[model samples]
Target: MKETDIKELNERIQKESAFVDMLNLEMHKVIIGQKHMLESMLIGLLSNGHILLEGVPGLAKTLAIKSLARTIEAKYSRIQFTPDLLPADLLGTMVYSQKKEEFQVKKGPIFANFILADEINRSPAKVQSALLEAMQEKQITIGENTYSLDEPFLVMATQNPLEQEGTYPLPEAQVDRFMLKVIINYPTKDEEKHIIRENITGAFPETKAIIKPTDILKARGIVREVYLDEKIENYITDIVFATRYPAENKLKKFDGMISYGGSPRASINLALAAKAFAFIKRRGYVIPEDIRAVAYDVMRHRIGLTYEAEAENITTEDIISEILNTVEVP
Candidate 1:
């Protein structure tokens, strides 16, 4: 692209992305900290992918998603997954209506535009698998009828990191369906102090519905048009390829640490996520920084850690960091 075209695109992006500021201001009124978490949620929504949130309890994980749902004109549902949760519970079941003399298909909470799967790990594999299926297909089958979910559908799931006694770990295949796996931490003392005062005063601000559902759909279309260079595409491919063929790519240090690497979906998500990050930054073209900004979330849950790496206290983050640092930027 020419310099003049690039300049024009950037200007257009700035004009279209003005709502981002409004969104940030409204979200901050209710949320004290965790800026990264908020941005990741927007990215996932814009990219049309599900997100997995890992954090300790009482970190405002639930509140953040709730506040976000309130800011947009969309249907929101919060499903509390427990030990007794069933597939029919997550996905709507068919109930026979004697008056109608037929089975009526009732949709579940998955039909909403935004879903907060609170404590998703508390459920069994059957429930988890059902949710993931809806996420991947963007629709669900009720009895003999298949229903398509509404557009702009996003699932933001939260799971406690400290508890494993009653939790069921997500299978690798199921976890791979999520586009990003965000790890959130506690807030700073200053932010915490502000939170305490605000909670006690009963003067918490609320986020108005700033954008319509169509606005978001339009923004996503713009995000898809964002420029991606051929070199940048190759860069994304190499990063995912490194995870699979580390030794061949001169990353022998991680050869034994990684039992499995990212799949092709990782490459696709990385490119889409990088484009969304660029759009958020009001840029028309994706740079290496855009890719780096989202690399952790996109690749974290995709890699499988080896027994040797686990024995040595190595984590998927460590492997991802190394891969990002070693991969040459175009």
Candidate 2:
């Protein structure tokens, strides 16, 4: 890309940055901290992918998604996953109407634009499977009728990592369907103080509507048009390739640490995520830095570690950092 092209792209990116900043401002009203978490959510929205948020309870995971849905003017639905939650409860069921003397398809909460699957691990695999199909295909089939979901469909599922009691862990296949698995940590001392003060005073910031669902859909279409240079594209491919074959890529530390690396979806998601990151940053063409910025979130949950690595207390973040350091930049 030429300097002139870069300048033009940068200009466009700056304009888009205002829209992204507006979203952040709205979310900041209800959310005290977790800026990175909010950014990952925006990236997921721009990239048109689902997200799995892992955190302890009371981290504002539910509040954040709801606030975001409000800001974007999207329909929001929250499903509290439990042990007895049935598939029909998630995907809707067929009901026989007495007046019509025909079976009617009553849609569940999953038909909304933005759905929050709260404590998703609390549900069994069978229940999870119902959501999996909808998350992947953006549609549900009740009896013989197939219903397409509303446009701009997104599932922001949350899971409690600290507690496992009576909880069914999400299968690896189900986890892979999510584009990013974001981990939300506790707020800082000052942010916590702010939260306490706001709660005590009954004064909370209000999130104003920044963009409508239509605007988001248009922005997503614009993101698809964002350019990716061949060198940067090769760079993303090489990083994902290195994850699978660490030794070949000269990532010796990762050889035993990782039993399985990211799949082809990782590469594709990386490119799409980088474009979204760039789009949010007000750039039209993706750069190596954009890929590096989002590589961890995109690859963290996709990579599976060995038992030894787990016992050694090595985390996916550590492995991702190593891969980032080891991979050559374009």
Candidate of highest TM-score: 1
Which regions of candidate 2 fall more than 4 Å away from where they truly are?
A: 1-13
- Which pairs in model 1 have colliding backbones? none
Error of 2 at 166 (Å): 2.1
Prediction 1 TM-score vs. true: 0.96
Residue-wise C-alpha lDDT for candidate 2, range 64-89, written one tens digit per residue: 88899889888999999999999999
Listed in order, each prediction's TM-score against the native is 0.96, 0.95
Candidate 2 weakest ten by summed lDDT:
8-17
- The lDDT leader among the candidates is 1
Task: Please give the lDDT score at residue 71 for candidate 2.
Answer: 92
- For candidate 2, the per-residue lDDT at 4 reads 79
